[model samples]
Target: MATMQSLAFSSPISSHRPHQQRSHTGLISSPWVICQSTHSSFNGQSLQLPQPRRVLLRGSSKLTGAITMMVKPVIQFIQGTDEQTVPDVRLTKSRDGTNGMAIFSFDEPSVFDSTGELGEITGFYMIDEEGVLSSVDVNAKFVNGKPARIEAKYIMRTPRDWDRFMRFMERYSDANGLQFVKK
Candidate 1:
């Protein structure tokens, strides 16, 4: 077991107070980043620890770029579901990991039942060999009262939550035969 050690800060950290206004969800291309201590690991193996705390990281452009590479995942398209492969559909998440949106055109809108014999709206989920990565209640756009395309938004309010999602994506991509490319 790798011993957990405190990362001493050169400058004493002041009490952190979250801003009342929420930070806008955007890509982390700039030279600033936020961080939190959620998981610990050794030699590429993850170890879940009992201590839970928030970590904020602010440093030079070099540090920012390195952290960005670690957290910023290559965006990907959801090829299809377990039953079949559907093309031209993609999922995008905010760089800060606040939220994600998935959208695709509905070729056969008539097949949609809106409610699957239940009172709740239709929902979409991405499940791999392991389990569901994320899910959201589906909403569709219409043209002349006919469904044209569908979209769903899921939320992950913190960087920690986003990290978990990325782990799921790693496994989901492997099982689904999907590849993420930088463009």
Candidate 2:
């Protein structure tokens, strides 16, 4: 068995770099150039002059651009239970670690139940902040001649891919009581 000290020799993860570049900062440009021009009559008219040069458009700070990028995520939530039609669901995230989802559409409740039978089970899904799928499924279980199981699936996801999924889930949940369970 290797001791903790021996195992801690080195890890490639330490050298792992995502190569992230700041869009507004100098990271996006290599060797930025600052140009200046001095006006002179026969190179001897430096008696008096105002400010050297005026900056046209100021470069946005990396922080401001990051804040705006962080604010534009569109997320919605919903919950329901149905069985016949396919449940349309969407998953998304609000912030870095928070999560949410939406329902795209749902079927009528009438189609979910019979005169004396187990009702259909239905729900939706959402994408978490990491861009993984978290789903809510309702299953109506029938054993022999009786209904036995009604279950649901609470899914999970990452932060990156959440937004695209949530827009789809928003519709169905709007029609039914949104059964979103956050972890």
Prediction RMSDs, each to the true structure: 18.9, 22.9
Clashes of 2: 36
**Leading candidate by TM-score:** 1
Model 1 C-alpha RMSD to native: 18.9
- Which candidate gets the maximum lDDT versus the true structure? 1
TM-score of each: 0.37, 0.23
TM-score of candidate 2 on Cα atoms, chains taken together: 0.23
Worst 10 residues of 1 by lDDT: 4-13
Off by over 4 Å in 1: 1-122, 128-137
What is the C-alpha local distance difference test score of each model?
A: 0.38, 0.31
Clashes of each: 2, 36
C-alpha positional error of residue 77 in candidate 1 after TM-score superposition, expressed in Å = 18
lDDT of 1 by residue, 1-183 (tens): 223222111112221211222212212243333444333321133635333233345665323232231212222123121212222335555654455443433333322443344344335555432335455555667779966555554455555555565555554343334454332
Residue 138 of candidate 1: its Cα lDDT? 58
Residue-level lDDT for 49 in candidate 1 = 34
lDDT of 2 by residue, 81-139 (tens): 21332332333334543443332332232233442353333243333222324455545
